[model samples]
Each structure stands twice: as C-alpha cells, then as structure tokens.
Target chain A: MKAGHRHPADDDQDATTQLAGIATLARQLATAPPSVPDIASRARAWRRRQARKLAPAVVAAAAAAAVAVSAGVIPGSGGDSPAAVTAAPAPAPPMQTVRFLSSMASVAAAQSAPRPDVFWYERVADETGPATESWESTTQTGLLRAADPQQTSAIAPTAAVTYFAYEPLTFAQMRALPLDPAVLAARMRATLRASGRATGEHRTGSDQEMFESVRYMLGWGQATPELRAALYRMLATLPGVRVLGQGTDPHGRRGSVIVVALPLGGVRAMLVDPADGRLLAAGASPDDASPDDASPDDAASQAPAPAATPGGPGPWTPPADWTYRGPIHYNVIFEASGYVNAVGRRPE
Target chain B: MRTAEGFEPWYAAEFPRLVASLRIATGDAGLAEEAAAEACARAYAKWGRVRRMESPSGWVYVVALNEVRSALRRRRLERNHAGRLRAGHAPPPADPDDALWRAVRALPERMRLAVALRYVADLPEAEIATAMGVARGTVAATLHSARRQLARELAVLTIKETP
Candidate 1:
C-alpha cells in the first residue's frame, strides 16, 4: 500500500496522477442513468424545505480535470438486468420466455387461486415483494397451468450468481451409472428425501414437452447451507459433471440449493441438496448447446434479434474487467426463455 | 426576498453544470437530479435568506450536495446488505472501482457514508463533514479508513488487465 502520507513529494508529479484519475472518473460518470420521473418529482418537492447551510465544493479545478469525457442520456433498455451490472451476462437477447407461465396452472398454488385469477406466489420471507410470476400472477409471469408438464427453465434472475450449499456429482462418477433420465430422477428423489426435503412427480412445460418428448420433473423444498454443502460433495460424484455453487429457488424454497455444472455446451445450473444431494432446480445454457437446438421455435417463425446500438459499448462483451455495477436488486425470470424482464430493489 | 431576479438567471445558466455535480454526487444522473431538485426546492423555499447570501448558487450547490449525501446514506442503511457482503468477499473482476461501489454499498451505515462522500461522490473532506454532520477531522479519518478497507479488499482487482 502507498504510504498513508507521503512526505512532500514533488507537487507536480503528485498533482498529475491525481488529475488523470479524476479525469477518468469524470468520463465514466456520464452513463445514461435510469429516468425515474417519480424520483425526480420527489426531489423537486424537497425544494419546499428551509435553507440548510452550505457545503464546500469538489475543487472547480478538479471538476474540469476530472472529466476527460462527458455523459449523455439515451433511450433503450440495456436489458442489462441487475445481474448484468454485477456480472456481464453473455451477449444474448432475452428470449420471450413467459409462455412457461401456463405451466404454473399445475402448481398447487395456481390450482387454488380464484378463477379469473392467476397464481398466488409471494416472496417467501418478504411477502412485500412483487407477486412472483411462476408461483403467482400470470400477468407478471404469463400463465402456467400446474396441470402442464415440466417447464424449460433458464436460470431465474433472482437465483443467478447466488450461492448455496450443494451436493455435486462428478462426471466420472455418473459415467459408471445407468445415467438414464428415470434413473437420474430416482437418484435425485432418494437423495432429496434423505436430506429432509421431498420432490414431487416431475412435470413438464409445453416447451419442454416439445423439446424432445423428454420426461422432466419439477419440485421444491427448503434449502439450507448445510444441505448445500452436502449437495456440493454428492454432485461431484456424478459423471461428466462439476458443481460450481448453489442458489435459491424463485418459487421461494429457502431449502432449495442450486448447483452449477458444465454438462453439455455452456455452464448449466442445477439445484441440489447440500445434505442428501438431490437435484431440485436446473437450467440450461445456450452456450453449452446451440440456441437453435434449445429453442422450440420453427426457425421460420422467429424474428431476428434487434440490432446492437452503434458506437455503443462493444458487442456486449464482459467489461474488459468484470466490474460489478448496480441496478443491483432482485429479478423476475421468464421460464420459457430464461430472460429477466423486471427488477426492483430488494424489499424490506 | 430578492424577487427571484438576482439568481434565476444564474440558476438557469448553471443547470447543466449543477446536473453534472449532482450526477457525480449520486452515481446516477437520475438520482443526482432528484437530489439537485430537492436542494433547489429547499433553496426556493428559503429564497429570502438565500437571496441575501454571498452566492445563491453556492447555496443551492450545498443543498444539492447534502441531498446527495443523505440519499446515499439512506440507501446504504436500507438496502439488503447481506448479499452485498457475500459478493464483496468474492474475487473482484479486473476493474475494482466498478465493483467497489457494490461492496461499499454493503458496508455499515457510517462506513458507507464515509466512503461514498469521499470517493464515489468525490466530495472534499470539508464538504463531507458538512454534509454528514461530522467534524472535518473525522471526515478525514473516516475517508482514510474507508479507503484502507476498499484497498485491502480489492487488492486483486487492480492487477487484472482489461481484455
């Protein structure tokens, strides 16, 4: 670390370094910030208050030296979810994924809602948050028919970048087993039940059904750190798999532990038990596999993604250095496309 | 009151500059404007007193700066700090300051106040003291501590080259 106070170094050099840092800082401050009209109005409202004492200024000299560049506000969604701020999500447009909302109709909560009503999901601990789409409102998440099959899930926004204790299975271990989907499902069930969690019959979403007529199941339970730790160990035993970490479930299962793996194309995440090592929630990546293969769309029907803005940041690569920025908050993920549509500050 | 003539033109002339000031103060232009607006509102309400002041624009600047400080403090205090702390412990990407704000936001109320006022907002020690209601000496120390903590945590960040 530089000394806390350097003895009088030549003022010129010291001044120069400070100037450059300030200049660079000013350039960055110019990004287009969210245009929140309400916040603006509220601030203006404060003008009604009494005169408070004045404060000193950042040196005027510094302001000029600080800005090598200036900022301009622009229009268009960065589609940069809060996650994009924390970690640059790969450059892929948000897929229209709400179709999985119909899968919710089959969920017990959805099945119980009043007719003319949709699901009734809430933030498990902090119920004050937005109506959880997958578990609650159709407008928020589209419509999910609990009666439908298992859904194709992308990583839910709230669950991504989050960690939990997990039982991981290594690819080597899995290669030795039957490795069939039923066998995999049974292994998952036995593992979960042992960890004080339970799994429901796997269900499928319309998209998942169309994917390959594969039988996919979905379930939920509480996830704890201890459970996650166990999941980490167990998942390491599965062949062709590696557990990265864990995350919570969007459906509000605190006991649900998430696991990350590189099974096929890109890094895929799976929710598993830290205690018994059962898979709970899982998501696919277009990187590991082709987006074309993953999509249920008839190529002819899908629209091309919007073009990138000109002279904007690069074709959406990670910040040369991944700097965690914020719009840091919670996200609502669409199951069909795994695209995050909405976000709000973490509620009290 | 000075009938609004003394400063109306100046305030209008300084709008863009003031916007820049608030922008830096709040990290986001949108938030900065809100703070600046609040400060202006306060100025407007007290225009009689402000009109007599040496520099009415300075008065507005002070108010805006205070609003910036207060808003940031509130956000740090109210935000979910747990996830932030956990993320802070993780390795930072190449640009530490980009990620530094995240960890800074996760800090306890006082620490966050000290850090943002000093660095993110880049307010001077005297201004921070005035904004935070602390002694100038305390602002220096607070700034020192905040910098130390961030430097320690982001030791790995500065080393990574930009791709």
Candidate 2:
C-alpha cells in the first residue's frame, strides 16, 4: 500500500487474517476470469453503439448552442461584469425542449380548474406488474385494486397529499404555493432543505430530485391548472434539462421526450403528449442501452408484456425514424387520471 | 486525447481485476461482466481525459460501481412494484450454502461495496472512498464494521458445522 493509505485491517492481526481469507475465497471464485476478446474490436463496437445512441442528442445540443451563440448568450462565457455580480453562465436550455414545454404551459393555463370531486381516480402501471387502479377520496380514504385477479383488493387510509420533495401539504398549503417560476423554484429549494432529505452538495442530483418531485405533483397532486403551468415553466429553467426528441410509451402512444441528464451517466426522461400536454410516461435509462434495446429476458422479468388491444392492434414497435437513446431501467406509464364520483369508477 | 495505443495495454491489464472486484461487489457474475465492459468502453471513449487522472483504474472502478448501483436500483424498483401487485411478496434471500460468500453478500449494500473494493480490488481506503463517492473516514468505518460482521458470521457458521 502507498504511504498514508493504510488498509483498515493493518492495525489488527485478526482482522488482517480474516480479510486475507476473504480475499483468497474471492480469488478462488475468480480463478478463471472471463476471457476478453480483442480490445480494439470491442472498443470499435462500443463506439458504434454509442454513436448511434447519442447522434440525436449531439445534433440537438449543437443546434441549441448555435442558437445561444447567435443570441449573445454563450454558455460558460464569463462576461466583464464583477465576479460578485456575474453569476456563473448556465448551460443554454435546449431550444426544442423550451418550445415544447412553453406550449405545454400554455395548454395547461388555458384549461380551467377542475371541479371538486369526492374521489380522485388513477390507473397506473410500471415495469413491475399489471396495472393498478386506485381511487382516493378527499377524506383520506382509498381503495386499490390490481389487474391480476389473484391479488386481493386493498382498502386503506389514503396517503397524505405532498408536493415538491415529498413535503406533506394540505390543500390550503398547496394553494398557497407561489405561481412565479423563480419564486416557486425558491420555495421548492426551501422545502427540500427543510425536509432534511437533502444530502451532499451534488447540485445535479438535487435538481433531478426536485424535477421528479414536481412531476409527481403534476401527475398525482391536486395542482390547479395555474399551478401546473407554473410548474412546467419552472422545469424549463432547471439546468441540464434537454430534449431527447420523440419516443413511444409502453402503450404505444407517441410523445415528445424531455430528459434531465443525471449526474451519473444516464437520464430521467418524461414523455408528454404533444396535443394535450398530458404526461404519458416517465422512466430512467442508463447511458449504455437504448430504450428499445432492453433484452427480452429483462423486459419479461421486470415489465408486463404489452397486452393486445381488444380489436385495435398488437404490441407497438418503434418506427424506422425512431430516435434511439439510452436503456430504460424502469418506465411508469400513467394510463388515466380524473376526478370521479366514487370508488372503482374510471374516467370516460 | 491519448491515442488508442495507450488504452490497449491498460485495458488488457486492468479489465480482469475490475471484473473480479465487480463480481464480488455485485453477487451476479453476469452483471459484473456487463458493468465492467461498459465502464471500460466508456473509459476508452474518453481516454484522453481519463488517462490524465491520477489513477485511471480508480476512475474505471467508480464508473463500474455506478453501473452496478443503477442496475441494483432498477431491480429494487421492479421488485417493489411487483411486491405491490402481489401483496406480501418478498425477494429471495442470498444463497446460504456458502457461509463465507453468504456473509459477505449479506452485508448492507454500502458495506459490501466497501469490502469488495478493499479486499478484492486491493484498493486503499482513499481510493475506495473516491470510487464509492464517500469520505475517507466513512470508508474506514464501513470496512471496519463489515469485517466485524463477517468474522462473527463465519465463526457462527463454523460452530454450526462442527460435528
């Protein structure tokens, strides 16, 4: 070991012996390490895969950067202003993402607040199992039913309303949240700090977490049209958020994808319907695998195979023009959500 | 950017060690190979930058560990989702037939990673800390705790097996 880099077992003979024994066992397990092929060939293959996956992102980023340069908003260019006055230059937001989100905000704003209903119903499914249907009432009671017949239906107290960092909120508290994007962003930061869940100074992870929280509120919380609009606008201001072009949900619905690049190599992607601005699906994908390149075994183990539409079609496949990105780890699709009169009722 | 010439020798030397360490860290051999290959490919892609680091091997370790973590998180989420659908469903426990390996595998996730890096990768606490993205002190504490737990578990196993 290098000087000043002591092993934990160095001080104790027994610990050292134990670690050595463990090391020996580990070595025995690895006696025949998997054979490696030609390094150059492997590297070449990897480059090809990555190029195919990253081409769209590279083109989109280049276009956005070009637009920023033309607009005199060069990224990472520190101007002549005093250091105190001049904040670090932020990455230019992807122009296409900005446009799509701005449109989503407008669509959200044009809609009126939903009428008060006794129950809120949602049908959701993830790469886990069959779809789950839940009906929650304002009275803090709810019923949950799984599509699988073997699973027993559950009737329990509803989960508390929460928003932006899982900070519990009452209807009054949610209504009092600021509407301006900057102010709302500040409020969210404050909420994250106060919740005591924020750890480390990793800014990118915190931003990604905040984005997910806002998405959760938009999908399930009782956000009014006005609040939803503000939330969408706030998302546009977050650094590292970008457009991953178009993609399809598990249900075969086509939507525009906006992704937040995770600090570690991957992305948290949300797909939104272009016409209505409703969120269709959300998922995370590692940097290596393309979204549609998930192995059959992995898909079968994790996600329920897409069910055939009653009389419409079979499982959806990506078209030739589909943009390939990263491998999806887990995808949650929001099948439907609406106010309802009672338990077990779905939106028409 | 360092030319591909520099990457070939380093890749040949470090790849097997990385896979071995990752195999211990992740109980799944297949995941270890996949993560190691992926991390090496990434390193090769960014060889110019990675070669300038104090320890290129340390960088590869971090990337491979992150890959393993992402996969584990995905599996956990899927399991949780499956658990919800099938109420009371639980994932199977790690294999208990091999007491030593079982003890190592049974350690908390962070502790397991620390142990694997320290023993299998032969990394010092400082490098392990960097790879795990924790403070050096935290790495020492984690390894210390893991050692004690492993010793106790192995002792118990030995006693149980005594005729």
Candidate 3:
C-alpha cells in the first residue's frame, strides 16, 4: 500500500527524515540567544504608532515648536500655551458657526497672491515664547532663525531649498493643481498613498490627510490665495468637521476653530482667523477615555514621562500624556511672509 | 479582546519558526529577526483582518522576504562591503567552512526560501506554495531540485574530505 501511493510517500518520508538535521539546526538557531526584537511587542508598538499616525491633523505642529511645547521639562517654555486660568465661567452662548467658516473662506479668497520672488520668508511666533523665522527659495536655498541662541544667528546655509521635503510648489504649480475639490481630493490621496504613509490594512486616504496636505502646503509650500480657498472648500465637504466656537490661539490671535473627530477617539482642531481665513494654530486631543481599566487619575499619573514625540515625517505628535483634556496647539503668527531675493535676506 | 487572545498563541508558536526560517534564508540572523518582526508588526496592526486570511503565516513569510530583498538592494546601493556582512552575507560559520550552510546559502534566493520553508519552518507543500505564491507542484519540484543540488554539493564536499 505504501509503495502504491502516488505521492512518493516513502521517498518523501525519507527526505523528511533526511532533513531532520535541518530541523535540529533550525531549532538550535531559534534557541540561540535572541538578537532580534520581540516581534509580538514590536508589532504592538507599530500598531500604536499607526494608530497615532491615523489620528487627525491637529497634532501636526511645526517641528521647531515641538520641544518647546512639551515645555514642562525645558525651563522657559516660550510661546507655550499658557495654562488658561479659568476665569468668569459664563455660558458662552452658541457661537454662529456657518457664517464663521464661509466668511473666513471669503476673506481668504480675496487675499492678494504673493508676488514672484526668489525666496519665501515667514516669521512665526508661539504664544508663551520662542519663535522661528525661516526664509526659503524656489532654488532650494534656505535659512531658519529661532529664539534659542543656538538657533538664532547669522542666516546659515542649508542643502535643500524646497519647502517641507515635498519641494515647495511654485505659485503657478499651486494654481495648476486640480481645481475641483473632488479631483483635488483624489490627487492628494494619490500623493499620500504614493508616499506609503497610507498603508495600514484599513487605510483609505481620508479628508484628514487632505487637511494635513493642505496644512503642509500652507506651512512649507507656497499657496496662492486661490489654492487656500480651494482647500477650505475641499475641507468643507469632508465629514466630521465641526465648529468649536471662537478660541484664542497660543499667539493670542482669536480665531474660530473647526475640529475634526479622529479615529479611535481622538480630535484635531484647526484655529482659523475668521477675519482672514488664515490657519492660526493646529492642535490634537487624544481620547483620554480609552484603555478600559485605567482611571483618569491613573492616566494623569502616567502622563508626564514625555513619551518620545514623533519628529518623523508628519508634523504631528499624538497626546503624549493621557491625562490632558486640552490639545497641544501649534500657533503660527506670520509676522512677515513674502518674496525675498536671497535665503538670508528678509523680504522688504 | 477575543481576537487579541486568539493571536497571542498563534504568534508564540510561529515566532521561533519564522526567526529560524528567515535566519537560514537571509544568511543573517539580525536581518532575519528585523524582517520577521516588521512583518509580524504589520500583522498585529491589521490583526482584526489578517487573522481572517487563509494563511497568515504565509503572508508573514512573503512580507519578510520582501523586507530582506529590499534590505539587500539597499545594501548593494550603499556599496558598503562591510554592510553586506551585516545583512546578507553568511556569517563566519561556526566550523569556519561549514559545507551544509554554505551550500544552502549558495542556492538561488527562491530555492533558499523554499528550502527554509520546507525544512526549517516545517511547512507542508500546500502552505509553502501559499508562502511562496507558487503552485503546489512548483513547491514540490523546487524542493526536489534543492535537495538534489544540496546532495551533490555535500557529496563533493565529502569526497574532498575523504582525500
């Protein structure tokens, strides 16, 4: 019967028996002192990281401000959101939300386009302290200055001039982007997907990513007023966007905030100047209420260890401490932004 | 939570097998672990869905192999001969000239993966087919070819040893 088997049963068994030594080798190698990371735990860590990445854009702040904002450790937290002294607890009547977003959009649309020049200059100030003044050129020459003495000095030379790794789009390129919000959304989705950032099994480029892309353009890339208007229009179509009433930015700039609820109990709020439709600040508040067994007090106790802030690709950092109820806001107060002839030279 | 509980045992059982198979296939233990850990992490991230797939282990093997290939490609790009020792080149064999491991590493990439999945991972032909994304018969043939070559190489080594 064994000889009659079509599968070469005895031969296969002989092969398997012959390969037993290989199995022994494998088992021995497996037993060798593990030089690699624990996959199970590493997998869990990656999931946590992806979960944070999938969270909305509110956590996206400028890179320079990140260290200062987690300011409890670094003395003299410049431009950090002042611990709001809760004052007159008045019933802040229902804020007029629609008129707010649309009017902001109108002002944003009407703003004049920046004139063509060699460099784009911007000075951004935070609420409590620290500010970064950056000058960039389409030719890829760049300079950055910050309040920190180390950061503040003679305009230094940098290798690349493109705004935010995705080379800053020329004003013309910004205009050439898909004008239709739906088409624009698709284009942005394709860009995000191509970057491989949108790769978790359940990923589909959501409006949240669009929001970040737009913010990135606004922060690093040149965005014509028309492009800014289109971004707002695109954002208006996305689900889960809501007005959070009027709030003051860390820069003390008053703006109406629109919050987007993120996946797995997180929220991102963008503070837009209702007067000019300028995005003043962005912040994120994670769902402090997750983790079934932990009490709020337990969370607060776990909060201050200053978990590694993500300084990777995106400008965002998830809520490091589970205890915080408020968002960590990145306020951009543009003192001067225009075309400059050189990287070191501020625009006249 | 139920799914989490379900995956834990599955992970524990496969972790060592994956490490050993990848170690043999890539000829670098550290690279093997990194690749396996990365694939396993992706699996965990999508556990809610990955656990439902027909062969999750197969998926992991595929992802790990890709990782190794990419690392090798990157190492080639860097033109760092020293870096090659870290990722792809077989380490100094314990016996200095270990014939078996040298012969296994000498196999073509696909054949090496086939051999590792077959003997080290101890996977059946059907599952090996799933892991390698080939037909079941192809896996069988590949294993046969690998065995023949390995046997020939070992014979030559033995003859040389006898002399």
Model 3: fraction of native contacts: 0.33
- Give lDDT tens digits, candidate 2, residues B66-113: 666545434322323324322532332232355667777767667878
Off by over 4 Å in 3: A1-44, A50-99, A124-129, A140-172, A193-202, A286-336, B1-163
- CA shift at B59, candidate 3, in angstroms? 14
lDDT, candidate 2, A1-348, per-residue tens: 231244435534444576666666655554332233444455677677555434433443354344434434544455533331224344445666677778889988888787868766777777656766766566543333334335525321224454455444657778898999889987886665453322211121145555666766766677888988998898887655676767888888888787665432466677887676677887767552344333211221121112123221111122223333665543678889888876766778
Candidate 1 lDDT over B25-121, as tens digits, reads: 3334455555655666555556668778766665566667555543433221122222332242333122226444444443444555555445444
Q: What order do candidates take by TM-score, descending?
A: 2, 3, 1
TM-score of chain B taken alone, every candidate: 0.51, 0.79, 0.76
Model 2 residue B16 distance off true place after TM-score fit, in angstroms:
3.7
- By lDDT, the best candidate is 2
Q: Which CAPRI category fits model 3?
A: incorrect
DockQ of 2: 0.18
Better model by lDDT: candidate 1 vs candidate 2: 2
Candidate 2, CAPRI quality class derived from DockQ: incorrect
Best-matching candidate per TM-score: 2
Kindly report which residue stretches of model 1 are placed more than 4 angstroms away from their true locations once superposed: A1-24, A27-348, B6-29, B54-124, B149-155
Better by DockQ, candidate 3 or 2: 2
Clash totals for all candidate models = 79, 1, 7
Q: For candidate 1, write residues A1-348 as lDDT tens digits.
A: 333333323332342233335324444444332233433444354432111100001121133222211212112324333322223332321121111111211222222212222332222111123322233223432222221124423211111111111122222332333333334434553442332121111111111111111101122222222322333333333222322333555564332322222211133334433343334344444342332222211110111111123322221111122222111111222122111222321212
Cα lDDT for residue B117, candidate 3: 94
